[model samples]
Target: MEFRYLGNSGLKISEIIYGNWLTHGSQVENDTATECVHAALDAGITTFDTADAYANTVAEQVLGDALKNQRRASLEIFTKVYWPTGPKGHNDVGLSRKHILESIDGSLQRLGTDYVDLYQAHRYDHETPLEETMQAFADVVRSGKALYIGVSEWTADQLRAGHALAKELNVQLISNQPQYSMLWRVIEKQVVPTSGELGISQIVWSPVAQGVLTGKYRPGQQAPEGSRAADTKGGADAIRGFLRDEVLTAVQGLQPIADELGITMAQLAVAWVLQNQNVSGAIVGASRPEQVRSNAAAAGIRLSGDIMGRIDEAVGDVAQTDPALTASPARRPA
Candidate 1:
């Protein structure tokens, strides 16, 4: 696998970051999760991204157990805060000083690590003052609980303000984690440019559009059993919008492109995101070990300008490009 510098920092992360969002503690068994993690390591993925909110905090414990034997220095671990975790208590959410400080300790304990390579805000907390949030992050970095800081799904304006405050407090805001893929281009218009100027890189998730870009879901047909859209817990909800006939047809139109490149649809999807110079990494999750290996093959693959144009023409306007579509919750969960 290939590696790239994360933002302007000295840190380098695997281009394909192994992430556990919906599978680890909720959809798949612990043994299965362990196998996937091992597969990622075997595939040369040194970066792992998770969140405290995933599976109500069980995901971190599962990932910790999976990587308990690896040399800690060999990995780049990332986790996030700002979502309601642990029984969803009144004080358990947002980026307030109390929440930020306490969440780091809890995450460290759960992940079985004293410090994480990166800590992130899961979303923009509209209810909390930005100053309070950035200062808390600064303390997190100063105390050595985390090496660098980042935010996910934040607007461009929000990133500018947060980056300015991070500079004032003397901390590094090096990355932005956003939902970016061939089907999701909302970040390209504004966030990409702003982050570029501020010396930040994007670690994009859902590079396969939650499996929609894998050419598994077809137009006017029942979703194949066991697909993400067929999942009932929360997967269906996450991928429902992309299951529209127009979107499915548009996605299927890329089959010829994938065939011509001698790559799978999933690889094409992941490589497509990495083609953007500002993207530092593309996050991929898996239920099976082979899936990890397959997605990892896209790490160093480069698409020419002509292929990119053809892909755009194939997907047409069905892809979501409206900048407004990239958004975070208006308020922290109660």
Candidate 2:
């Protein structure tokens, strides 16, 4: 595994960040979760990404237990806020100042750590003012509960405005988390460019398009049992648009590319996402330790320029029509 800077924040995070969204409290047992976390650390992945809402907040406990005996200073822990973590209630979610402050304390307790390396607002909360969210996150940083701040699934305009607000308040928003993969190229339009301009690196989630680019589901076939496609929680709908025969066929065409490159389709897909200069890291979720090991190897597989061009052509035209997107100039190493 290789490491890259988390945006321009002077923090070097592993290229393959182990995401605890699906495995810890959802599929893997405690013993298995420990095994997977150990495997990631052995493979040089120092970053672990999770969220408060992942599996009713049990994921944090599982991860915390796994790393209980390890040196905390050596690992980079990242978790998100802004999702409902309880029975339906009026103030159960969103980026309100009250929620942000309360959520971090709960996360810290569950993770058994004094602070997380990075804490992100899980998504944009239109109901909450951006200034309030920024100020609350700044307070998190100042209080030493979170070292840095980021936002996930936000529009380019939101990122611009949020960063500006944080700057005014003397707090730096370090990164942006968005879905960017071979199957999802929407970020190429504005988010990537805007982030590049602001020096906020992208820690991309679902870099393989929720396993569609893994070539596991072929055209006109039933999804294998226990696969993400078979899952109902935020997984079923993820691949719904790409469930068509045409999309599956396109995915199948990548087999030769993977074979020629001496890598799995998943590895090829992940490496392709990391090929973009704007991408700081790719968060990979796995149900097993071997899967984590396999996915992390993607960091070493460099896609050739010609193969990248071929991939772009194979995926067909994808329009990025987000109004918040802006054009970006070439990126220079910081």
Candidate 3:
């Protein structure tokens, strides 16, 4: 597996980070989840990313059990806060000092680790003061609960302000996790430029556009049985936007490109995301062990300039590139 430093930090992570967003503790059985984790380790993936809100915290428990016997020092485990993990009390959410302080301990307990390598804010809390949020993160680092800080799905302006505060507090703000794929190019315009300037690398999720780029959902066809689009508990709503005939047909056009390179459409999609210099890792989720093995092959493949141009020509018109689409909702459930 190829590795890269997350942002300007000296810490290195695998190019393909194994993530359990929708499969662990919800869609898949515990044994299946454990098998997938083992497969990732066998494929030389050392980085694992999960969030407190995933599967109502059961994802972390399953992931923790999967990694319990492994040498802790050799792995880079990341988790996030800022979502309602429990009862809907005011203190149960947001990036307030109270929530941050409480959330880290719960996360540590669920993860079966004393500290996470990277602790991220799942989203920018519009209701909380930025200072309070930054100070809470700084406190998390000082307390040795997290080695570094990151944010997910934050706008460029939010990132800049948070980064400034992190610098002032002497905290290492190293990465940003966002939804990035051939179909979603919102980050390229502003977030990437701001993050590049601030020395923050992107650990992008949905590099295959929530399985849409795999070309499994053909145009004008009902989604295959048990696929993401058919599994309501596993990202069905999120994948709905990309289920249009035009998008599916456009994705189909990339099959020949993948055939030419002797790669699966999923591998082509993942390799496409890693081509960006600012992307530290692409997060991939799986329900089966073989899926992990197949996607890991994209770690070292590099696309030529002509292939990239061909990819752009194939899906550019259907891609979502509006910077305005990058903003988070003012009020999430948390």
Top candidate (lDDT): 1
What TM-score would candidate 1 get against the native?
0.99
Clashes of each: 0, 0, 0
Give per-residue CA lDDT, model 3, range 1-334, as digits (tens): 9999999899999999999999998889999999999999999999999998999889999999999989999999999998888775878878889988998999999989999999999998988999999999999999999999999999999999999999999999999999999999999999999999999999999999989999999998998998999998857987999999999999999999999999999999999999999999999999899999999989999999999999999996999998888876697564
Quote model 2's TM-score. 0.93
Cα RMSDs of all predictions? 0.6, 5.3, 0.8
Global lDDT for candidate 3?
0.94
Expressed as tens digits, the lDDT of each residue in 1-334 for candidate 1 is: 9999999899999999999999999888999999999999999999999999999999999999999989999999999999999978888999999999999999999999999999999999999999999999999999999999999998999999999999999899999999998888999999999999999999999999999999999899999999888888788999988889999999989999999999999999999999999999999999999999999999899999999999999999988889998788887777
Residue 268 miss distance in model 3 (angstroms): 0.3
**If candidate 3 were superposed on the true structure by all CA atoms, what would the RMSD be?**
0.8
| TM-score of each predicted structure versus truth | 0.99, 0.93, 0.99
What stretches of model 1 exceed 4 Å from their correct place? none
lDDT, each prediction: 0.95, 0.85, 0.94
Error of 3 at 115 (Å): 0.5
